[model samples]
Target: MIKDSPNPPEHLFAVRPNLDTETLLVNASQDLASISDIAVHLAFEVDGAQRNVALGICRMLEGVQLLVNKALDEAYPAT
Candidate 1:
């Protein structure tokens, strides 16, 4: 009878790059831009204000909104 041969152990992983921070941050933003926010995705699809891409957009929009608000306020001040 032939002797049973032992199987080799599988490789294990310990340390790995920040898949989220490094990949997600950059990718998430790109993904958000090319495609609509409504599209399905693996990463967390939070609101713009809550997300980096959305937050970035919000910042720019906020500036424009502020200017408009300011102009409107100046044109028609409260009596």
Candidate 2:
């Protein structure tokens, strides 16, 4: 007998269940900011329609970043 598939890796990239809301929101905000920066840079590197598409993605990411930052602020307000 043989197995059809091997076991999955033990160190898969996944959110830890024990993370608190503030930590999660902070991580999410950082990730969104990084993605937006990438999209902006790629927009400048491309031409025509592709550039437009990248810019559109950047805009959407910016909206999401705003939401995430707001949530983070609300979850952990400064003194």
Candidate 3:
């Protein structure tokens, strides 16, 4: 079950590793791809609103993937 918190802590934050840009991008791309795959699988396995939510997550991840790829291309242009 999901929990909802009203007025959630404003200072909530995660401590990120001190990784370089290329490493961070590679890690994020792999993680997001894994999440997208899981979301796609769960979406097909479920019905109604739950499936819709899962598909929505997949779509958001796809968008992020595109943006990340663009950043990668800009960072390391093709020869």
Candidate 4:
């Protein structure tokens, strides 16, 4: 049987609206670090241009992680 219309998309994951800035920054920093690790590992598995691209992605993710960390530090200073 053919459907007349497409079914609505289901969102399996979403951020909690009540989360504070520090929590969000921490999560972002962790995610960026994880992605950077994956990229670095992938870079080793490939060669030439593909390897360069993966390493480049790793570098960019590192920069983003630094930014997130800075924001977190600024938002919640240590005693």
Question: Among all windows of ten consecutive residues in candidate 2, which has the lowest summed lDDT?
Answer: 3-12
Q: What tens digits encode model 4's per-residue C-alpha lDDT throughout 4-71?
A: 55765477588889998988998899999899999999999999999999999988998989999999
Model 1 lDDT, residue 27, Cα: 49
Question: Residue by residue across 1-79, what tens digits does model 1's lDDT show?
Answer: 9865597436555434665443433444455444433322312467554566655665555555565555545655668
Residue 40, model 2, lDDT: 97
Count of clashing residue pairs in every prediction? 1, 0, 0, 0
RMSD, one per candidate, in order? 17.5, 3.4, 6.9, 3.2
State the lDDT at 2 in candidate 1.
82
lDDT of each: 0.50, 0.90, 0.88, 0.91
Per-residue lDDT of candidate 2, residues 13-75 (tens digit): 877799899888988888998999999999999999999999999999999999988888887
List runs of model 4 lying over 4 Å from the truth. 1-12
Which residue segments of model 1 deviate by more than 4 Å? 1-44, 47-50
For model 1, the run of ten residues with the poorest summed lDDT:
34-43
Model 3 stretches with alpha carbons more than 4 Å out: 1-18
* lDDT (Cα) of model 3: 0.88
Clashing pairs for model 1 are 48-54
User: How does each model score on TM-score?
Assistant: 0.36, 0.82, 0.74, 0.83
Q: What is residue 4's positional error in candidate 1, in angstroms? A: 83
